[model samples]
Target: MSIWEEHPLARRFWKEGRADFPIYDMHGHMGSLNTIHLARAEADQMVAHMRRIGVKHLVFSHHHALFEPSFRNVRAWEICRNHPDILRMYVAINPHYPDHIREDLALFDSWKPFAVGLKLLPDYHQVPLNDRRYEYALRFAAERKLPVLSHTWGGSSCNGYPQLAEVIHKYPGLIFFIAHALFGDWEGAERLVRESAGNVYLELTALPGERGLLERLTASVGSERLLYGTDLPWFDEYQVVGGVLSADITEQDMRNIFYANVERLLGRDW
Candidate 1:
């Protein structure tokens, strides 16, 4: 065998192929422009790409649904139902719609059988990370033992690790996923994971330019607290996949970051 073929992670990404180590995509979206790209068509496209690259499952939240809330959630629910084995949902929560918070949580809870977690975008909504409104969803997730994925940036005014720390402290039972590795604050993201409660996990979706980030994070925080995700429709999957595949970590660390950590959040045996 060639030297490259001898490396476990290299073999998984190149030689051995998807059959042996299928990827579980932690973040994705159903194309928002339903008129031009229908939900089923978007689902088909996502599935085709997954098959092409050996991804067996996807835990996704719809882009439009994240903003539209109730209306698009029903559409997302239907799409998940159509591809039950391959697709899962993240109930999108927008704090701007405070009146809809409780009602939307109830609806999302009812679909708990199909959802993997909840997706929050405080930055997009122009809401602070520790806003009182989000506590509604946080409380719900804690009670149900569901994970929450929130958009996090490094130096943004509202939604970043500093604000997120408060939420993590308040609800220890709820697992919090810091989205996009602090939106490129690799070191800060690692520190957040280090200091936060066990329930907090870092989502690894940093771009390729941030070289050695994955290796550093794996060393500092260990792989158990890291989860792999590709902010799919907004960012190319190849970039996200390449970031992890190029990391100078062990095959087992790759396994933990790519799949095992997420399964842990879902309370599934890995």
Candidate 2:
């Protein structure tokens, strides 16, 4: 039998909606979008889904916070405050509005542990990840040693491997979560994790669908560097949870990817 065939966690998840495992999803988005329909995009619905799947916590940015220049992150803060047990938020930064970025940063500490870190979508915002406009946010995060989740892909100029490499080198103190694991470039993802001096993390948002990729990453960098995430509302929680549970890696590695690593990063209190 395959490893997961006999695994208790796997069997439990198959039977119950959840398992004994504690899942901490590091990447997710809330709210409906103009382009696509998100069935369970509301905060309450997302929290319910997290509970059903044994997710202990989720750190997410709202769709409006990322897409609407005027929406800012107040709504995200409010939602997180309402569901402090299950949700934390990333202060979304649109490099296009340096003033708004500054304002948000200035009030960042007020959000406390609820505003866990920052989120960057360079591709959607039409700027490179390492651009000057993002310097303030990067520097702020680096100074405070905050986790920054950035949407990344393989070949795009905005938040691709090259741009990510530059930012990683420039801000070694920042705990950078490379969302999507550079999408199509698995080799680059491995190399990036191998070369980093321990501050870079590969967040598995859209990556669990690529069979064997998780095992490859776990083998390459160990599970300490691999973070569990599902772009919830966009992706199914059980599908991604099943992906990790069924991987060839050990249960300890699965624990690290699911929650231990994130707990270490965000701390036990968070």
Top candidate when judged by lDDT against the true structure: 2
- Residues 1-270, candidate 2, lDDT per residue (tens digit)? 654457877777777778775788999999999988888999999999889887888999999999998898988998988998889899999999999999998989999778989999999998999899999999999999999999999998998889999999889899999999998887888888888889999998987757888889898888999998999989999899888887878888888988899888877677
| Clashing pairs in model 2, backbone N/Cα/C closer than 3 A | none
TM per model?
0.88, 0.96
lDDT at residue 90 of model 1 (Cα atoms): 85
Task: Please give the lDDT score at residue 258 for candidate 1.
Answer: 69
Alpha-carbon deviation at 23 in model 2, angstroms: 1.1
Local distance difference test scores for all models? 0.74, 0.89
Candidate 1 runs further than 4 Å off: 1-4, 16-19, 33-41, 267-270
Give one digit per residue, the lDDT tens place, for model 1 in 183-259: 76677777777777688888876543368777777898998987877766555555666677677778788788767
Name model 2 segments beyond 4 Å from true: 1-5
How many backbone clashes can be found in candidate 1? Answer: 0
Query: What is the Å distance of residue 249 in model 1 from its true position?
Result: 0.7
